[model samples]
Target: MTRKAPDAQTLSLMLDNVKFDSNGLIAAIAQQHDTGEILMLAWMNHEALEETLQTGRVCYYSRSRQNLWRKGETSGQTQQLIEARLDCDGDAVLLLVDQTGVACHTGRKSCFYRSFTEDGLKEISKPEIDPGQLYARPHKH
Candidate 1:
C-alpha cells in the first residue's frame, strides 16, 4: 500500500522541522519512487515546498530565474510526488516521485547521465528527445 502524506495542518507543522539555508532555500533531490533512480536536484524555498506538499507536484525554485519553477512546466516531463522526506539534519529533502518523462533538460532520463571512466569523463545516456522539441512552448509557470 502507498503511504499517505500529511494533511495541511500536519504538513504546516512538519515544515517547522525543515532547515532552510541562509538564502532561504533547501536542496530538493528527486528520485524514482519504485526504481530508486536519482532523477535530478533542485532547490526549493518555503513557498515552493508548501506548494509541492499541497499539490503533490514537484515544485522548485530556480536560481537563475529567481522564481518558482514547476517541473515539466515547459517540457512535458512531470513528476508526481509519492513521498517527501526531510534529511536527518533538515538541510535537504528527498522527493520520491513517479517521473512521467525525461527528467533532464538534455532530454535524458536523468541529469547524472555522465560517467567517470578510466580514461576520462564520458557521456553515456543519449537524449531520448530533442530539448528544443520538449520546450517548444514558452514557459509561464
Candidate 2:
C-alpha cells in the first residue's frame, strides 16, 4: 500500500517540534518494526532527518565524519523506514524500520550485543557474519 507524504505545512510543523541538541543534532534510535528489537543508536541532523522523511530511507549524521551518513551506504544492510516518532521532549527520535541484513558493523544483528554482568562486560552474541565482509572498503566508524 502506498502512503501519503505529509503536506508542507504538516512537515514544517513536525520539524519545528523537534528539539535538536547544541550541535544541531538529535539522538536517533532504530528498532525492528515487527520484533521491537533495538538495533542501533545514531545521530541525525536537520538535513538527514528531512531526507529520511522524504525518501523513506534511514539516514544519520556521522559524528566521526561530520557529514550525513546514510545507513547501509557501504554495507548492504539498509533500513526501510516503517515509522518515525519524536519523544515527548522532542530531543530524541525513534525509527521503526524494516532492516535489511545485520544492523551492526560488527556483523551482529544489533549493536547492543555486549552485556554488563557480574563478570564484567561480556559479549552475549557472536557475529552472524564476518566484520570484514560487511563493507567493501574501509569505512570510518
Candidate 3:
C-alpha cells in the first residue's frame, strides 16, 4: 500500500515517539528503493532533520565538516527523498530516495562498494562516473 504524505503534525508525532541517541544525533541510512541499493550512512541533528523534511532533500550533519550538509550539493548527484522512516528505537533513520545520479561521492551508485575479506578491503566495482568531472577538485589534497 502506498503511504500518503503525512501532515506536519503527524510527522512531528512520529518524531516525538522515536528514541534519539544520547548525543541528540540519529543515524540516517540512504537507500535506493527501486534497486534495493544501500547508498550511505550519515548522522542527522535536529536541524538537519527539519531541513530534510522541509526540502524533500536528504541532509545530514557532517561529522568531519562539523556542519549540516545536503548530499551532492556540489556534486549534483542529489538524493531526492521518496520517504523517510525512523527505526523502532528512533535512533536511526532510513531514507528511500530517487537518486539523481551516482550516490557515492567516489562516483559510484553506492558508497558501500568496498568489501572487506581476508585479503583486506578491496574495490569491487568501477566508479560509474568520474567524480572529478562532476565535482570540483578537492582543495585539501
Candidate 4:
C-alpha cells in the first residue's frame, strides 16, 4: 500500500510536538506493519525524520558516522514507512514499516534476535541470509 506524505501544516505541527534530546536526536523504533514484529531501533534527527515523513522511506541518523543513514542504501533491506506514531512524551517514535529483506546488518530479520536467558545470552533466531551477501562493499553499522 502506498503511503502519502502529510500536508505542510500537519507536518509542521508534528515536528513541533517531537521532543528531541539535547543532542537533537529522537529514538525511532521500526516494526513490521502486519506482523507487529519489531525490526530495529535507530536514532533520527530532524532531517532524517522529515525525509522519512515526506518520502515514506525510513531514514535514520548514524550516531557513529554523524550523518543521515538511509536504510538499505548499501544493502537491499529498505523499509517503506506505513505509519508513524509519537509517544505521549514525544521523546520517541514508533514506525510501522514494510521491511524488505533482512532488517539487521547481521542478516537477521530483526535486530532483537538475542535474548538474555537463564543460560547467559542466547541467540533466539538464526540469520536468514549471509551478511556478506547483503552489501556490495564493506559496511559497518
Worst 10 residues of 2 by lDDT: 132-141
Model 2 Cα lDDT, one tens digit per residue, 17-65: 9999999999999999999999999999999998898888899999999
The predicted structure with the larger lDDT, 1 or 4, is: 4
- My TM-score estimates for the predictions, one after another, are 0.92, 0.93, 0.84, 0.94
- Best candidate, TM-score: 4
Question: How many angstroms is residue 10 displaced in model 2 relative to the true structure, after the best TM-score fit?
Answer: 1.6
Pairs in steric clash, model 1: none
- Local distance difference test, per candidate? 0.92, 0.92, 0.81, 0.94
Candidate 4: residue 85 lDDT (0-100): 96
Candidate 4 local Cα displacement, residue 131, angstroms: 0.8
Query: Model 3: per-residue lDDT, tens digit, 8-127?
Result: 896677668666678778889999978878988888988788778777878899888889888877877888788888777668899998888888878988889999999999999889
Per-residue CA lDDT of model 4 for 1-141, tens digit only, reads 678899989998889999999999999999999999999999999999999999998999999999999998889689999999999999999999999989999999999999998999999999999988988674443
Candidate 2 positional error at 88, Å: 0.4
The order by descending TM-score is 4, 2, 1, 3
**What TM-score does model 1 achieve against the real structure?**
0.92
